[model samples]
Target chain A: MSTFRRRRKTPCGLLSGLLGVIAMATVAAQEGPGLGETPSPEMLAAWDIDIGPDGSGLPAGSGTAAVGETLYMTNCFACHGPEGEGLLNDRLAGGHGSLASEAPRKTVGSYWPYATTVFDYVRRAMPYLMPQSLTNDEVYALTAYLLYINGIVARDEVMDAETLPDVEMPNRDSFVIAYPRR
Target chain B: MSTPEFPEEEHEQVAGNGLLHRRLFLSQGAALLSAGSLGLMTARPAAAQALDPWLLTPGLALSGYGERSPFEADVARTVLPVAGTTGSGASRTPLESLEGIITPNGLFFERHHAGIPEIDPERHQLLIHGLVERPLVFSMEALSRYPMESRIQFLECSGNSRPNLASTPPQESCGFLHGTVSCSEWTGIPLSILLDEAGVSSEASWLLAEGADAAAMTRSVPLAKAMDDALIALYQNGERIRPSNGYPMRLFLPGYEGNACIKWLRRIKLTSGPQMTREETSKYTDLQRDGRSLQFTFDMDVKSVITSPSFGLALNGPGLYQISGIAWTGAGRIRRVEVSADGGQTWAEAALSDPVLPKALTRFRMAWRYDGGAATIVSRATDEAGNVQPLRSDFMAANGPQVSYHNNSTQAWAIDSDGAVSNVYV
Candidate 1:
């Protein structure tokens, strides 16, 4: 009976002086307002889409270059060119041995340090007009197709989270950290 | 080329090609006015002019917001969009037309990959997760309640001054050649407070900051920098941040390149190592002469550029003119700026403005008396860290000729006998 009465009076008190009570409690507790809420797992699932080079956050999916060709023609060719030669947007393939040349062509196959970056970028932003719209499998296929065209992977090679992290990029060891030595 | 007709006086010639002392104007303003028209004040006689309508009539009523004068409409940032797109491009600040160090919010340069997003402050939230003891989310209102601090700092894109890398000097305006940098007074809550609230894990060495735009831009920053002086900036130039500059909030790392200061910031995840995002690997990396590339280059090099008497701002009849420019360094405060008027054969120390804060633009000025001859002029800056700005040839020799980023070479402008100024490789 006493617990029910205390719970019944709580809503009325909250409606009357909730902000003032919280303000006082916050000043007594910490430096900040301390209004940060613990994010739920559902919220994390919806927004935490970044994938590390070690394939830490890659979702469950599988695809091949053959399946990616159709998706590429439908969505990517308008901006990135038919063969990834770069039409209106950036070039995605070729330029394997041009880094030291007078006119270097910086592309994914030639300069990218990690293969996981391909999946992270295409999943978050691709097709120029519509970003964050591709599914996990479709993003994997596109990554496979790009790697295949660049001669990094075979046409029939499967690209899942397990195999994608092992695909070594040619320029993986070509970088040196330039600042904040630690 | 003709010499000065007036008699010689206390104005000391500091360097070759008629470079005068730094304090010529301040020490001898009244005496110099009696000498001649110093070539700057060319206004028409006021006695011959009638009363303007603005003075004779009532002015417009008060407004909630204000704008620059309509007569100054021509002073605008020059935008160059990417092919077949309107937003994925850069716009340069009119550095030549502006005065002082603080760039007005409207005139700040912009380099956006997926355009600006109109974010509602109430709906925006900042999530701190990953290798943190407490994964938390804070609303804009909650963050606003935290203690805030304000700082005046300069932000520069690493891609600024790309034309200087060319062997032949390109004919372009000073702003067009090197205007990707701007300074502003940013107000924000120190990011350390938020990190403290989140209780960062001991294993975390780096953190990935992501944006809320269509591209969802992301970059991995060292935890040392975050624990240092980084901020979650909410205001620019004493007002709410402009849409193009990250409306609700943005991450601001003092002295770092502009792109690393993610705009429209939404998420931060502590990690054991860098995520190696495409923005860092496929782009923003600097290529070296020996085929190796420099990654995670955050600090902008010490640099300076002369804004006045540059290309398109021709010298009128070559009399006494004030040479002015801006200098900044990511390492620390700018200690000195030297001006050269005779193709860098000699240099004269210019006067730096007061309160030379670190990571902020320092305005330097020098008094110069032109001799109506073809002359090459330039400026170079030295920071408190003992690093001097390099010449184009030396910079290119160090970092390959094909390199396109962090080109902090001195810019040379030539003034012909006809008083027309153009970019020249000296």
Candidate 2:
């Protein structure tokens, strides 16, 4: 409990506490004018595609690093380079400990905090020209492949919605929520 | 038929006819001169020339739509080459060419994650789901029906002055260095009103605003801000918002960074916590010297720049020139702007333009008599909240060299003995 208390004093925890205060302040019972109609469930399902850090809203799909390599080589290697080292685009792998150095090459492995975000971003926008055209299984395969290249996971490990969020990233503890004080 | 036998007699007759014709021509010329004098008495050419050109040339009638005069050059936004793809870069406003506070719709700066999406207003709908009781979907028509409000405010990118963070001072024009900020009279409905209409749940702490562009760009805004001064803007500068400025509707947070105000807004999902989206994390987050990053640095600090006599502008002998520029603050209205002629040694308060609005660009002017000796001019803004614009050295001391975003340090322009103006850190 003392260790938990110490953790709560961090910048991230302070921000979370501040958000809680704001939420509590606005919880007063207020009535609405009741404008706009409720959308259909089908419409909600289609647009409610954002996968949070906790693995919520991830589609039912599974793939291994081996399968991901094939998909990545065929589809993603054009702009992302052969090993996701980045060509004319963003470099995706091998930037560990560079954030502290003068030249911070912030790639997936070096800076990204959540593995779920990698899946979400890839699923939402990827392949440069063709976005949202990848299948569910293809997205999982690509996510697994990217993780493997970043050295975050083994080559034979299978990635699904359940297993993806549990895969701890190297920079998980690097992120801190801080709002500049006046 | 006999070819008129007397040739000498015919020649004398022809000369007499010529004299008669000359007399007729002189009489006609005298009549036209009299008429011209009479017309001059009724109408003045000076005033007529000053009137609309359309009146002079009535043949060139109105077209389907009016266009700016051909004399006025179409100022294009300066695209910053940062993104991998062509579509995902930012364009800066042409600040040097602009006059007054409101940025023209076409010349307004644009930052797109996935290029501008051509959205049909009828087909586009704003979905308010997640922690809302109603989970409502508002079409463009429905959103327009809500109570409307308009306010003139400035929106600046967080990375507006990132180039200034370099070890060496940038030599670009003031517009090229600081053109990512623009002011406009935005008209829209209060986001609080919409949240009320949708019946926001008590547990909601954050709102995830997502765009309809190919990138589906998302940002998590604090619910407190949404309930405070946020707006679902539909119009800019008294007209419908331009396609580049976010056509049908956009989330406009008056004092927040430009990215917080998502363009082509499609969905806003309420949540108990921030989603930690890509923009809030990997992109806009500012890195510190210690390697930790600062997130949600939304409000742009007070900043002022000397637009005229800046880089690329030359002063001709420099007698008494009115040094004019803009000052703004995200926290509140600019209380005052101080101009330093000798590079921060002594400061004089500049005259602020009338109708000094809150969170809007306040044009300030100061008269300076330059004797052509080397001189540096700088302006510093102080907001009503008592936040003063810091010098570059002070800002670097506080935020370090690794910090790039939210740089509102006072900028100095050095004028050489030859009357050439250039950027310099004093």
Candidate 3:
């Protein structure tokens, strides 16, 4: 439903569209879709927070884990620890075997069920004090550092929106969606 | 002098700077006995508390300025925290710190899921529609004419302590535990009276209360609760409601979670069942194992914690420090609060502060003294309904982590030789 894209019958585009119908329409007055009217364009813009099953909210950003290492040192390393094991805050890494115990020590790569949620949450709010101040690229790099510390990715990996969504999380399969069926 | 090494020898001991046993201040056996035998027997009134620099008696002579000025520096903005979990980012009023059956309007705790809305009184309206004999919208003037009565009651957030009772209970001072709850003398038309005015149909099973905030937050209340004790509150603590605590108007659902008592209230649409709003469904509901989720868990149940001599407080010396704390129950008046200084090994009943009204926070005080040794303190509250506050271990063992929100277990803090206080697993 997105006015930005359409089924133009370009044979190759048909194959891509056949996999899934991504109808993100940004319009109203034509009796609209989704069983109701779309929220005002301004409201929609404010609340257009959706992280795809594959990580949709990942903004247009790219980063090298090496650059992320530098950014983490300056921005998040103090509270989150030199390698994200936590300092005054909490351990954001480890937990390779913590989920089933009395305490579930959650971390980025180990407990988070989605890569997209990580990128989306960091960009929207992170570092606690200077939340949303980091550029999208910095969020990507920081997320890369957290993942690398959790052993989910190689420390040298560079990530962009396209590739960031594809990065799988360790506990993604463990999370059974417990809602919407209610 | 022995390196302050407390090996925990199954006595629930913690040794460090300022580490008192979570049970030290909470216990009674020897602590209270020794306090009676040796505590500083000063004849000072409760009003003469040294901790509060601004402890003013209620209805004091005042200038034209109407609102209290405790948090006046931020009055112009009247802003709440950006989101959940706050301190320097955004703080809140301390209700427990005040000594009153009714918390002042400005001091009523703020629980804004969204920021406080800038509502224009002129354009503001209260619409009562759907499943009623006559759907009607009441302007502010019309709402004032209905018979008004004031009653003192307390409201608490369902998720107030979701983060407090971790492996180590936070010694975040009493405001954090008891502060999330506030009591007020609310003046408004009883909701049942309003339903009579609206002529609600008997078939109406639920009432959907929605706020005008940007979130447009909504929740459904049972008709029984709506027609029973809920009030369309206009005044709080004997004054016009503060904007942060749902000024202009709010729904005061007695003995229910504060979230259900919607603020900046706008509409009341009667319905057959719960709307399953985002808050009740996705967020507030406690997800238990076996894919079962607990929803509509309304009542706040019985809970209490000692505020004074709580965490973060350091005693210059341990002789004759009066131990005091607050306790309350959504069910009824708190019957008693047991304090254990020896980590639950021994207990003594504390005296309840006067005017202990049901559904209002009760202040309990007991005199205790320290004998130049480190110890732990713990407090447990028992309500009229036989609901006693659980120990942390008992709570976590039965409830589990997936069960988020409403963890009103007994909170324990340890005091050390250095007069430092800390939260502990015990």
**Clashes in model 2: which pairs?**
none
All candidates: DockQ:
0.40, 0.23, 0.02
Task: Looking at model 2, give its docking quality level.
Answer: acceptable
Q: Give the per-residue lDDT digits (tens) of candidate 2, residues B207-322.
A: 99988888888899999999988989999999899887888889999889999899999999999888877788778887777788778888889999988768877766634355
lDDT of 3 at B140: 75
- Ten-residue segment with the worst summed lDDT in candidate 3 chain B? B1-10
Cα deviation at A130, candidate 3, in Å, is: 23
lDDT digits (tens) for residues A1-182 of candidate 3: 24322323445867756633543233211111111112244543444333344554456768767778999889877777897887855577887666555455656655665566566556544666565578878888888887788888887898887887788777655543322222
Give the per-residue lDDT digits (tens) of candidate 1, residues B125-145: 999999999999999978877
Q: Model 3, B1-426: lDDT tens per residue?
A: 111222243133233222233343344432533433222233336565465644555555867966555554432222235433333222344533555355566566677654667788677777776677766667777676655668878888876655565655655655665466777788887777656656678778888887766545567788888877788899887777777767688999887888889887877877665554545544555545433446677888788776556565665555545566778888878899878776777777766767788888888765454555786777889998898999878888877565567878877767788767676655
Question: Which regions of candidate 1 fall more than 4 Å away from where they truly are?
Answer: A1-31, B1-9, B25-47
Instruction: Please report how far candidate 3 places residue B312 from its true position, in Å.
Output: 2.4
lDDT of 3: 0.64
Cand. 3 TM to true fold: 0.61
Estimate the TM-score of every prediction: 0.92, 0.84, 0.61
Per-model C-alpha lDDT, please? 0.86, 0.79, 0.64
Off by over 4 Å in 3: A1-182, B1-62, B66-96
Contacts from the true interface found in each model, as a fraction, amount to 0.76, 0.49, 0.01
Best by lDDT: 1
- Binned by DockQ into CAPRI classes (incorrect, acceptable, medium, high), candidate 1 is acceptable
